[model samples]
Target: MRTKGMQRSIEDFSRALEQGYAAVYRRNFVSVTYEYMGGYIEEITGYAPEELTPEMWDSLVLHVEQKGELSGLSKEECFRMNRSGQVDRWQADMQIRTRSGQTRWVSDMSTVLRDESGDCFGTLGVLQDITERKDAEKKMADLAETLCLRNREIEADLALAREVQHALVSGQLKQFPLDVMNEKVRANFSHRYIPASTLAGDFFEILPLSEHEVGIFFCDVIGHGVRAALLTTFLRGLIEELVPQGDDPGALLGKINRSLKEVFGQSDSLLFATACYLVLDVSTGMIQFSNAGHPAPLCLQPANQVVAKLESPDQTPEPALGIVEGYAYTTQKYCLTAGEALLLYTDGVFEAYDANNEIYGEERLMAFIKQHLDLASELLMDELLHDVRCFSTSEDFEDDVCLLAVVPTAVA
Candidate 1:
């Protein structure tokens, strides 16, 4: 393409300017000269046709290497000579401060002029302004940074809420009674507690204040969030404060009832909870228990034909703890032989439903317990939880689910 144009002898500079430099001179144009800048350059840079000096030309050329801004020269070579009579090529898109301290972005297209014979001649140039576009790009970048910061803040808040929920239920069943009988009687315990949101209303804990005694309870508060969590904490404190020193099932429930009545009355906010509190006396092999509106406890006696769900000595579902004041709570006294086992749980366990919406009901749980009968308490706990997860196909519980099991090494 260049060879054809060379043979044509470049009759009209306009054709050359239009073909090769149209984009550079879109605003305006003038023939190559040493003394004058093209109209396009003057219009874009807010500078007069003759005001571009030799210093401006040198600065414009050097500006290309200065990053974080724009600069350079064009092919026209119009403003190579300024009023000062100095000689050089002028660069464009160079930001410069005027006498009034206002900044202007200029697109310079200036270079040394030459005739058809290619003899050395003075310089020529063109210039245009580009400040508005640069400013807009910078503003967009700042907004993007601000949005990223906001997203990080939201993520951090979610993490904090999740931690709070885990803290509420984390250490519930930690200390089990390992040395219950003459020989070391061991029981393994495991659980799955997952809330759809940051915090759960479910809570579980093993109360081991002494060497031979343990008070364990599982409770589900009415709702989810900070409020529900606070209620669970309140109920936990009440039970811990009132649980008796002696291994008396009846007394323990009575004390819990009195405390709940003192704390909360019939409020509109469904402030209720289902709970099972038990006192296990390792030396006596006596398990004293009280259930307040909770699920029936299961006894897995391998020696027996089928797993048995212990009947509440009181036939009806007792009123939940915080509802009725001064109500009598009945106690059930049972004994576990050396090799028998007892499984205690909250409603969440059996109520867990799968995608098909089938509840992991009492019947299924009993069958699982019977199947894993000969296993030690620890392995049984693990198998039972694994089975529940398999049945539900998920860890999400319908309500607060807690499991506590006690097994003796040998039958008395």
Candidate 2:
């Protein structure tokens, strides 16, 4: 019969059997023999503690390929290292087969036991069943690998889409050396496009309506990235279909607005875009333009040393596309002279925030244009973008930017 204290100790040890078993061993040089085994040893291995001989335990230590610190090491190596005093303790995640033929993972931890003389004797150790934890780790690893592969595939697709968008913009701009007003006037164009990410919502196209007339379409979707990029593509297709209406900027914008309304009606989320279209007759330097809640374009007059926004005649702005179906957009006119340049851009340009959280607003942009009026179209576009970036807190734009500079001159 056991005393109450001994019984309590036994019960406490038994309760620990929920996860693992503990054991003591006796050692003679490099050889080890079991001295005692307790706490669910039999329940875990399906073998009586008496039956678990040193040789049997060694046989159960299945050789497995492991990673990190345990790589290329085995139980035999661990014993040798312990005897040589190379290590104070040893730990390993090991696999073992039970009497029932079930393979299970276990965390084996042991410390070298020493006598009063500080001479090595044996080891005291614990073997905890960690099969569930190991299985969960494996599943997580597999999931991470799958996610990485999917991300790579997505990146590739986005790269292709970017290339396609670039090609489309390039194709539209190729209709250059545009002669108008009976071949007495020539039109030149320069542009810059930058995306905040792999894709952009800002898009522009130069349309050669006829020998004397050319059209410029600029738009900014509600946001950036994949969704906004898709909308830009859709808008590109709509622009192609609405080429007949392109002669009148207002009519073209009206048609685009109705088309966007029809498409957005099916979705619960609200989506919209700001756009501007302008038809320039190179011969007379007359621009017929319309706006769909977009930022007003700037006109630079080098002859007069003036810079100003091309606001509507009535100074009332129209709503953006995808809102207010059947709304009529009115076309406004502006006359350009020799040495004058028209600058069209998305809001990303002036919306940049500085380190002080102040916006590089339209006033600053107009001031920049006024100061750099003598620069060529290409140089101006590059300088404007550089200036905006310099003023930004992160030295980068948070939004996509698109700039189109149209300069018409007399063909002397």
lDDT against the true structure, each candidate: 0.60, 0.79
Backbone clashes for every candidate come to: 26, 0
Per-residue CA lDDT of candidate 1, range 35-93, in tens? Answer: 33343444444455466554554444423322211223332332333222334344445
Q: Superpose all Cα atoms of candidate 1 onto the true structure and report the RMSD in Å to 1 decimal.
A: 10.3
TM-score of each candidate structure, all chains considered together? 0.56, 0.88
lDDT per residue (tens digit) for residues 1-412 in model 2:
2257844664565466544444323333435556556546676677887788777876786744343454577656766776665676767787889899988777766677676777776665666777788899989999999999999999999999999877776665633444333454477777788888888999988888887788899999999999999999899999988886699999999999999999886888788999999998877789899999999988898878899888787789899999888999999998887778789999988999877889999899989988989998899889888898888846668899888888777522
lDDT minimum window of 10 residues, candidate 2? 21-30
> What is the overall TM-score of model 1 with all chains considered together?
0.56
Scored by TM-score, the top model is 2
Please name the candidate that would achieve the greatest lDDT relative to the true structure: 2
